[model samples]
Target: MSKIDLRKNIVQYMLERKQLAHISARVGIVLDITGSMQGLYKNGTVQEVVERILAVASKFDDNGALDVWVYDHEFSRLPAVTEQDFNSYVTTQILKNKNIHKFGRNNEPLVMEDVIKKYTVEEQSSLPAFIIFINDGGAVKSTKKVIVESAIQPIFWQFVGIGNSDFEVLKKLDSMEGRIVDNANFIHLEDISAVSDEMLYDQLLNEFPMWIQAATEKRIIR
Candidate 1:
């Protein structure tokens, strides 16, 4: 199916079922660009991921653009993508960008700080921020503190693990204490390429509506 139909059929149907049809928010996607991810990038799996994610963005974001970021030890905050430019986004924008610090070690806190800064400081908005954070394990301990501090803000982090790695920090997002409200969720998909779009969308969106409800009640999204 084309992207428009994918948005109108699968994602929108699920959003309506989950009662999120009228919700409005900013959408963004962050990718892990460590050495281990080269295979996924080379095989075009990353581009497919972008297309699937852009369909979700089309529904939730007013302008139908998905804000983009790829991070390793350092990061590169790329341009936002819409349906028009989402084709081959990973190859054209990320892989070819000489300035992007790619294939380094994973430093979750460094990128996490910049992500919070983008929503809370740079382009401050009242709308809640939904962030899709994809990684292949190696989640450092420093990310816990950042996630805890971000709990008070209007951002929800959805962490998706794509490969078989010991995702210690991401696995504990829910039970992490001292948060004003639960602000993040983690799901591991051993091979994202193997998952059907319907299932992938379901998994990606599972807890976001719940977060919207909780963040609303806590006045974190007002």
Candidate 2:
């Protein structure tokens, strides 16, 4: 089989295993454009991530379009990426856009708020929203409030720390208190390239299915 077919099949199998093949969600990706992540952007690692994520969206997302956002101190929500237009998406949609706020400081809460609005307010879907957030480092305490508040919404935050940087704030996601349900999860990958696609998919999907069940039972999602 061809590469795209293989990718879709792999994701399909993962969904079936999780017993999540029957569910549909809206998928989004939040990428950190702070100075620390410049190397990943320049070397095409971020592009590879988009392709892998798009594969997951194809199987799980209702529309199969991965909503894209890149951020530094400010965030810009770019176009949604579908299978046909995902090639060179990061380079063309993000890096090439002079209007994008690129490579500066970290302000996770600003973009985190935008993600919540995009899924919970703007789209207003009963289906759950699955967001893959990629950050290199520079976690701040203020980001906690955003995640805590979003717990009641129909959104699940899956945070992926892609480097050896101290992701202190993110590490607290699972244990955070005052949330109706645990809406966030974090995973650290020192070297994303060293991990296989199956492993990555497993890690990403590990907590999501459980969250869906919990959210449904609690009426957070219908």
Candidate 3:
């Protein structure tokens, strides 16, 4: 069978079984670079997890569009984040503060608001947008407010808790009674140790196909 047919079948199965969201969603990642993420793993480290996320994102780029935003209260203080700025920001700002494990960092929590504002103003397109927020800590009150405000948008907010993060924050983000608002449901990993290399790889491989199914249903990528 053709790849397209395979993808369709997968989508159908996901809808029937996983109740998974759509495919053509434009994925935007907001990773928390706090001080705590420096926690290590057996093979390599949590940095490996970060690398895995980047790798998965690269794969998704082929399926559709992908963008990553690494935030800390400190990083946001420097300047506005741009696609062009990711490199320097990573080198000077991120590496300077964050250890290989990546925890206990701060950035303007309001920066999320800025990102949403900039994205809305800059792009007038109608593609589905998904925000995959990877954070190990709680946001300040202001940041939480902005996140709650931004949740009102059509963006599918997926929270992935890194390390031993409190699930309550993530649950609040994902909670939406009637529509996709009033809550932010997230994909969480309670402990970094819980993810083996093989498991991570399998999850990464499945993510794109599941997203494609959701996208096809929403008519975003096609």
Candidate 4:
């Protein structure tokens, strides 16, 4: 597909144009690169989502960029994605990387911990972060513990399930115990192309404003 087509799809299904000015958090994009996601990467859905996320970050982040990561059995930190390099970066680092297509078990905690270490423990910056984590199925064991621990940090995890997989663990996260605040949201997208931008953005970002308010009151973000 042409880059224009990808941009059009992003505008049609992902950009929250009206809400951009209100968002002030730094952003991160995490994609599950397990075998099940091969079709998504091949058909350009992953690329489109990446572009859409960058669109949001460009408006909200001072740097106009996002940290990107991919995982299966483990996580790999990719070079930061910005508007300029987004297309080439995905083409070379993701679609063309031999390691991306390998089949491995899903491990969500690894990515979660990586983000926590970078933004929470290490930097300890008060800038709240929003993470878009896309996966096709349930995560490996330890995801629950990692998520619960991460709740105390200044981050919001928005889990997007692509395809028809059952996201049992993600669905139960909202009601999970021991969290300082409900810091995560989950949505399943059966057909990425068919969803409207407003609907997808609404579902993806609806809880974030409330999260920012709660986190600020808790002194997690200043």
Best by TM-score: 2
TM-score of candidate 4 on Cα atoms, chains taken together: 0.87
The per-prediction CA RMSD against the true structure, in angstroms, equals 1.1, 0.9, 7.6, 3.4
How much is the lDDT of residue 207 in candidate 2?
Answer: 98
Model 2 per-residue lDDT at 119: 80
Off by over 4 Å in 4: 1-22, 98-101
Q: Tell me the tens digit of each residue's lDDT in model 4 across 124-185.
A: 66578889898888676578888888888889999888889888888787788898888988
Error of 2 at 171 (Å): 0.8
Cα lDDT tens digits for candidate 1, 68-122: 9999999888999998887778998999889998888999888888889999999
lDDT, model 1, position 52: 85
Q: How much lDDT does each candidate structure score?
A: 0.89, 0.91, 0.49, 0.78
Which model, 1 or 2, shows the larger lDDT? 2
Score candidate 4 by lDDT: 0.78
Candidate 4, 98: how far from true, in Å? 4.6
Give the Å shift of residue 140 in candidate 1.
0.5
Report the C-alpha lDDT of model 3 over 37-135, residue by residue, as the tens digit: 444422344334444444333333324333655665543323323323333344454456343334445553545765576456676446545566667
Q: Local error of candidate 4 at 155, Å?
A: 0.6
lDDT of 2 by residue, 1-222 (tens): 856568889889999999989999999999999998999999999999999899889888988889989999999999999988988999899999999999999999999899988887888988899999999989778999999888999999999999898898999899999999999999999999788889899899999998999999999998
Best by lDDT: 2
